[model samples]
Target chain A: MNATPEQVVELLRQTNFSTLDWAIVVVYLCVSLVIGVWVKQYATDMAAYIGAGRSVGVWLGVATMTGTELGLVTVMYSAQIGFTGGFAAFHIAVIAGLVTFVVGATGFVVAPLRALGVLTIPEFYERRFDRKTRVVGGVLLSVAGVLNMGLFLKMGSIFIVGVTGLSPDSGALTVVMTVLLLLVLAYTVMGGMISVIITDYIQFVLLSFGLLLTVGVAIWRLGWENIFQVVAAEKGAAGFDPLQGEGEFGPEYVLWMLVVGLIGCAVWPTTVARALAMESTQAVRRQFMWSSISFTARFLIPNFFGICAFVFFSTHSTEMRELFLSPLPGGASSAFTPSLYAMPVFLGHLLPTGVLGIVAAAMIAAFMSTHDSYLLCWSSVITQDIIAPLAKSEMTDQRRIFITRLLIVAIGGFLLFWGLFYPLEGDTIWSYMAITGAVYFTGAIPVLVGGLYWKQASTAGAFSALLMGFTALVGLEPVRQTLAKTLAPVMGDSETIAAALSAERCGLAALLLTCVMFVAMSLLFPDTRPDARQRD
Target chain B: MSVWIMIWKVVFVIALSAFAVLAVGATIGGARDVVTLLNKLKQDRSNTKSDQ
Candidate 1:
């Protein structure tokens, strides 16, 4: 398994392409398209398109949540993380699930928010805080959503093309983006949550089938024990230890993720929309409770896939070093390359032709689900949060729908442009997602908690929290660069160390610190008073 | 993947993944059951109130 250049080349040669692989890819695509087309019957109006008419029961919500959460990049990164960092990377998935479970159990944040019957999280801010606070939250959520979506098309294209052994850099980002948008628009524009949930059920089944095939083939090639041994020998202690490594994230990373997972998970516009789509609080809570199981199961498989890739790559150190150490455009580090390449390499090496195609389709499904939700999420927030609040006219439902679809086109178009042209500099896709998330993750707690608890939390606190959280994220950029430089010698390679550091820490800190600041300021500035229009 | 273990793993994955599907199915089924039960309870309550 220690693949030198010669070994890699030989492996590539041994890997025969069959008709079965092509068949798998074709079949998967056709089925997903059919599902998209079929869901049209459910769409009665715009509300139905967005929230499935608040008709989503527990099962559909849970399934759709799983599908939305498990994106192509998630699988790719998990495999990549496993390939490089060993078992430690699995912690990310574990913590996310456990935290989500805790959130469900407590019924603390989202349960109450869902009970309020508001459309979006930012709308909650408008009701609870001031117009200015809502605007800030809305803008922040939209930007966060857009930036987080920056890599989807590129990453999806990479996975699809790579699995098919086609041109990896097809420069087809725009075409791919358009295809994804059209697919999402077709059903999403129709029945909204109904279409999303119904389609997601089928997609979830197919993806699970595909992942099982991939895992089976890999285990057949190298027994699980052998895989574990190879990885253990290669990575030593740091490989499996989630707490250690370059970031010095240690326990704090876990703690931060737990808090973010608990509070931030519910606050995101995309998820908030999903919660609102449910028929009732009981439905939302029950769906999540059941979802906790599915979430945990899916969580482990991807992490395991990652760990398997790590073990498989260990004996192939020469290739690993080459993949990691190679300079990316804009002086991007090798750390970014190998992990990114891990899933592709694993699929190319392991899967049987028929199963391979199925997996390819599953990857595409993941991409589409993520894209559709993101498009819907940001667009809704923008319309409801930013535009509608500011506009003097009471908007009609028809007008609202028109604006929503238009915003989708506008925002989706921007992402396509950014995805194609955005220089891959400064951060990994994971960090970018997290950093953008911190914009809300850090700011929301004060607003949400204050809205729920303290009547005295004035507009000043909300504004300060928003400003302070953004400042933390923006300020961390230079600090990150300096930290990378300072720790370069000890890290052996500075960029990976730097990339790892940000992914593990900064966002959570910024988010948590913002929460702390909001509470402190609210207590201190008690006399600032509330907006009368916001309350009864 | 061991033959036996692989079979079990496949089954487990399928079961876990089908949760969402089951949720939808159950909600419909559960609602019907609930409605029927509620109706029965209401009829008995009305009859008792009239007799009293």
Candidate 2:
């Protein structure tokens, strides 16, 4: 909503999204840079740079893991789900927490991977299969990972736009996206994982306060009972019932949530990097166990904010309410309305000035922590698994660090371009993330599990399984749309068929197909004799 | 369905409480650890300088 001169004066007086918040953001960036400078000298070796010299303790481990996982993009998307899906969105959190807790309790895939002491997931592929498999896995992983991160810049910028009331088409969107990227890349390129860990602890503390304050403001401004009542009234049984058909999450989605929870904590590379960086296997387990709370709270809190935004917009006067309620029926190809901005806009109205500044700073912390860790994680994989293997001679530590830094900047540049140009079309950002991530994790889950556990897992089986995961591309909305039309004669309705191809169903199908391929390939081609590595 | 909702609500309450306790514990524990780590790193840097 455009503020009148009087309204603008009143908003500035009341602490709306303003220059003071930007100052707060700049201060947070400076603090992070100082921390980066302080930590830079320690990252002389690749081991120290990539894995913090495998010395992260329980608390620092939890703090860094939480900071890394709970990105501003995470909050934005979770809030989107909550805004549209109502209380049904809580199921994702419950599933995420429960799965992470289970992994922590059982020392599942992660515990074993840590015991193996691999720097990246593909490094495990090399040990179990062959060097060739590792290189292929690395290439596929980096591509999928980079693609998966493609939308983070845009989604994060949307949160800033919505909250700070920037025009969507304004060049400021590009500027914000670029600035956040440079800040994160600069620190990550300087100190690597060591710098990421130090900054994360600071970010974690700020994030906790900002998180609690937002939820408190949301509840205080809109009564909790009223929030639930409006959802129930507007959405009925589906609003409160995650398992029912009235909402977006039903049994299929819940089943999908189970897969997400498992892969997220166990099979995902970045989170697993934390476990690999820990002091001990037990510490790794304890980290996940302690972090399960942060995982759950991360989703639950933002989701609550989204629901509150929905309620607040429903009651309050603004241009945002109408746009949020607009039916953007063109789907994936359609440009998004301001609905994604609703939660942030609500925060701008609710928070007073200094409090707004603090929350904004906390969010900046969230943004940097996630980006730096991800950039480091992805670039480290490209350096360690992909390029280091290709080089004729053993790579010097300096060269490895140099390559990783260059890759980080390159990736950052790509993200800026992708964020600006990528057409989201019909799918939700969260769903898009799930589908793209499945491109790697779907294949990796079966291969990693089989390699780690099942004695029959072979090089042939691993290659086949990883290749089979490419079929998950069908899960993307555009791909589904194209396929639906191609098969329309048999499918009956193109739109129905397209709509039926949810990311959850597509992922499960990919997992199953890859599992079959792995088992079949391994059994049929039975290694003349099991490799010694396999037996070991 | 109501049973399912009840089950989830109960589970959520338990999970939230458990998570809150763990987060608090980790934060306190981690803060102390971070201080010690930075101090040790500082000592190592100084020792290297002296040896040089």
DockQ values of all predictions = 0.08, 0.48
- Residue A262 lDDT (model 2): 92
Candidate 1 local accuracy as lDDT?
0.64
Q: State every prediction's TM-score relative to the real structure.
A: 0.81, 0.93
Q: Write the per-residue lDDT of candidate 1 for residues A310-329, one digit (tens) a residue.
A: 65655555655454334434
Docking class of 2: acceptable
Q: Interface RMSD, candidate 1? A: 9.5
- Off by more than 4 A, model 2: A1-15, A318-320, A328-336, A489-491, A528-536, B1-20, B39-52
Candidate 1: residue B29 Cα off by (Å): 8.9
Off by over 4 Å in 1: A1-20, A170-178, A246-249, A316-336, A475-479, A482-503, A527-536, B1-52
Question: On residues A1-536, what C-alpha lDDT tens digit does candidate 2 reach at each position?
Answer: 44333432233233287788878878888988898867898875788889987888899999999999999989988988889887788889988988999999999999999998889999999888888889989987898899889999988887776667665554767888988888888889999998999999889888887887677777787986688777777777787678786577889889988998899899989999999999899999999988888888888878878888788777776544444554533332133354576677778888877788899888878888899998999999999999999899999999999999999999999999999988776778888889899989888998899999998888889998888888988999889989999999986999888878877899889989999999999888765655546477
Q: Cα deviation of A450 in candidate 1 (Å)?
A: 2.6
Per-model RMSD to reference: 7.7, 3.4
